[model samples]
Target: MRKVLDPFSLGMWAMILLVITITATLGVWFNTERRNSNPDRRQSFWQTKNPQRRRKSAYVRLALDSFLQKGNFFCGASVEHDPNANLASKILAFGFGFFILITVSAYVANLAAFLTRSEFQSVTTVNEAIRKGYTLCAHPVVENELRSQLPNAKFFFHENGKEFIGMLKDYDDKKCEALVIGWEDTSTDIDFLSMLCERSLVFTDSVLAEISMGFPIRPSLSAGFSYWMYYGQKFEDINIPNLKEKYSPTEALDSQCVIQLSELSLQSADEYAMITVQNMYFPLVFFAVCALIGIILQCIYAFSSNRRSLIGRVSQLDLTTTGTTARKDRFLMRRRSRMKSRDGTQDDGRFRDSRIEATEE
Candidate 1:
């Protein structure tokens, strides 16, 4: 089995599983960060310290954290006076929250649309096609099987490759609804159809009939061939329908279901320019721009606040210096007046003594 099927290994599947695991891990991390970023919902040190004030029921706490806090996963926390985090931290938290919200919402929406399209566009069997009013187109080989299965069904028949291409063109032009060729034939011509119609054509998982072919072999090689054939049949028995499903075109397409950010095309068929950013990235860019603006505004606010504080301190210092100088000036003027009064008293005393001596003589 390894010798036969080693070329087509399950490495891709393993890689896909790894990717899914990583995506799930990142999603969990984002959710946790979003929760922790919320000031109201965030588990505080105080909450741990004051266990008596904590809510009794974990479920009630979760409900309050999710809803009553008036904060959205995208908008971050809306608590009035959260003392734990600062402005920069808050901005970063909100930015990351918004980024995650936008990214996750896009992923979920695209996934939903892809699933809906896959389900809505699929024709699992011929009866489903008929019920859905889809007209079947088939090559001459499968005509008998289709006729027997869908006797009253509307269908278009194509003789060869040329006719098949013509019928596909009609289908592309909306003249015909669906093509009901054999799975092998469809797989061979699918690339051509995609080249012609791009994504307008999609193949369904309906089989009109299964065909088995026989090859001639020499007697000498027949025995070995038969032995291998028996083992191959046994392998088929073990794998069965699961093998068919694993390689089905529908499942292959579903595996590639994702929203691509942008296409690197030289030209665009639309009115927009060729090299334009896809809509999915716009929200992220907008948020980043907003964060930059917030940082700038925060810096401006800090600078203005510091400037005002410095001016106030300078004014207070000037007022103090001016008051001290005025007090010193007043003290000096009072001392000079006192000195003049003392000198005048001394001069008057001398004059009185002289007058008394002259009168006695």
Candidate 2:
């Protein structure tokens, strides 16, 4: 059987990367959720000093330390008020500072790498070397280099103003062939290197250069980038119809799925498209839901406050017969002048009389 037919060969690196990423994501997600779901001040994880004894694993210990540190940052307890809380906070602060230091160090290392000549190597084929009348496409830079080296051979630029790199994995069941041009010189598995050497064709009189762009290889950082390099001017690798599927484009590319550079273009394209569409409407949806919730809460508050005010006002109001009689006496006194005016001979008196007769009915 062909070695490439093995499942282990197909997605080994992808699986390993996926595992690490998943762990980091879950750690962040569950950690945040645990904090939000259980805000009880009494239930602190740092209090258990022997947590490692119960739960074995350096990673777990690291997680516990991380959680303790984050907790301390949020809860600024004084040393005198709560010694334990203060200690936990200090431990967390130390860990946090350490993590930041490491991250900065990695970024610095990555930057420093760009200054030096990359160990990356490339195999070139002269336009004359390739079989005559065979279609050949290359990057503008690649094409220029070939043109300079081989003045006798004819060259045609790819259409669409875009160089055809390689077909990404196709939607068909069969995998596509790859046409590699150049690759980086990072530490790779010797076996994998040997496999590459054996399976890949190397051209005679190909120029080798020590060029530095960033990392050892493009694939180390981005699978999509690597995929392009691997299959430049090659056919696509389609999805197998009846293959036992662990992942799919539709489900894996959903908004719930996190974005990572390591995903293949077929997967990434779907994910990117989904995110682009959702982002367009996500803000509007969030605001609408928030407004609805706010309106409901405001109505509840208003109803409660109004009910309380009504009860309080009713208690203060007088309802005795004595109070009613006093009010009636005040009304009678106010009407005495009007009654006298109606009896007198005047246009106003007549008008008042008509109003009184209307009221009497």
Candidate 3:
């Protein structure tokens, strides 16, 4: 694990070390070369007049003289002190923005497709479609030729139907572009076919444009030479050589040049499904789980509050009954004690009165 992550973690440090080493080596070489080339002591006269101009002019003269001496050196000189200030800053800003846009746009597009369960779709040329891994639907003859050229791509076949019919209705529904028959169809009325072609923007001139049109054509148009036959010239221009076959020096040069050029023109689309699976789906699932937990907690709180309210009502009822019974007992005890004490006091007074009467008599 440590070894695996070391590359990503220490990439910046490695780059910085490389830059420092290159700068130090170049500086030492440049100083040594400058000292070796200019060993005269005429600097005393120049320093007396203007030291700043003397230093600047000496560096400029050295650079220009060095470039002149080296035949392979393709150097351009500028007198400005801050030659690339504005251009350098603008280029840096543009690069930063471009990288940010690429990363963010890739994220957003993938996220949208993932959440919706749909692939991001776009129309592309026949060559472009093949590059992006989309199979073309065509006749057996066309498929055979195409397959012979592109073994990696899978091709679909439609029997009896016209070329456009095969591509539009029979091919993969989710894919954006399909190879269809165009104005090159022979049996259809030329005027009507032209109208259809115009409405569909089915241009037979370009390989990609033909793939973009969603329609089929009759066999005469497929076999006969018209716009479709003329379009074969573009295929010749592609110049894809057979992998198994050997070629002459000229053929080899031509093949290599075409291959290099084709690679330059080609651009691979980002795979939205992979991005969605990696970035968006997990986050969405986690957020949904958190939401469900919150709802369960709310239900628990509501039930708990109701239970607490019922317990409070019961406690209040019991307290009220206890207070009323205690008051009633106190009242009854007081009444009985008061009656007993009063009767005792009356009896004592009566006995005293009788004794006093007897004594007086």
TM-score of each: 0.35, 0.18, 0.21
- Pairs with backbone N, CA or C atoms under 3 Å apart (clashes), candidate 3: 125-208, 164-215, 164-216, 165-216
Tens-digit lDDT track of model 1 for 1-361: 3322222125522432332333233222223222243444444422454546644475345545543332343334222234444454355455545545664454444444333332234554568778888877667766777788778788877654675676676667776577765544454343554543454444444556677756688889988988886787687653434555566544333333321112111111221211112443564565566456546655665677679878877577888998887677666655655786777855456654654543333
Q: Could you tell me the C-alpha RMSD of candidate 2 in Å?
A: 26.4
- How many clashes show up per model? 0, 10, 4
lDDT of 3 by residue, 99-212 (tens): 334334554444554454432254435566667876666665466556666677656666756556444556446343455343334223344334333334233333422233
Query: Candidate 3 at 150: error in angstroms?
Result: 2.8
**Regions more than 4 Å wrong, model 2:** 1-89, 108-123, 126-361
What is candidate 2's CA lDDT for residue 78?
A: 15
Which 10 residues in a row give candidate 2 its minimum summed lDDT?
A: 165-174
Q: List the residue pairs that clash in candidate 1.
A: none
lDDT of 2 by residue, 203-315 (tens): 23344233446436665668876667557535554323322132333342334332221333345344222112232243334433543454454456557767987888743
Q: Output the lDDT of residue 101, model 2.
A: 43
User: How many clashing residue pairs, candidate 3?
Assistant: 4
List candidate 3 segments past 4 Å from native: 1-121, 160-166, 171-176, 180-183, 186-201, 207-361
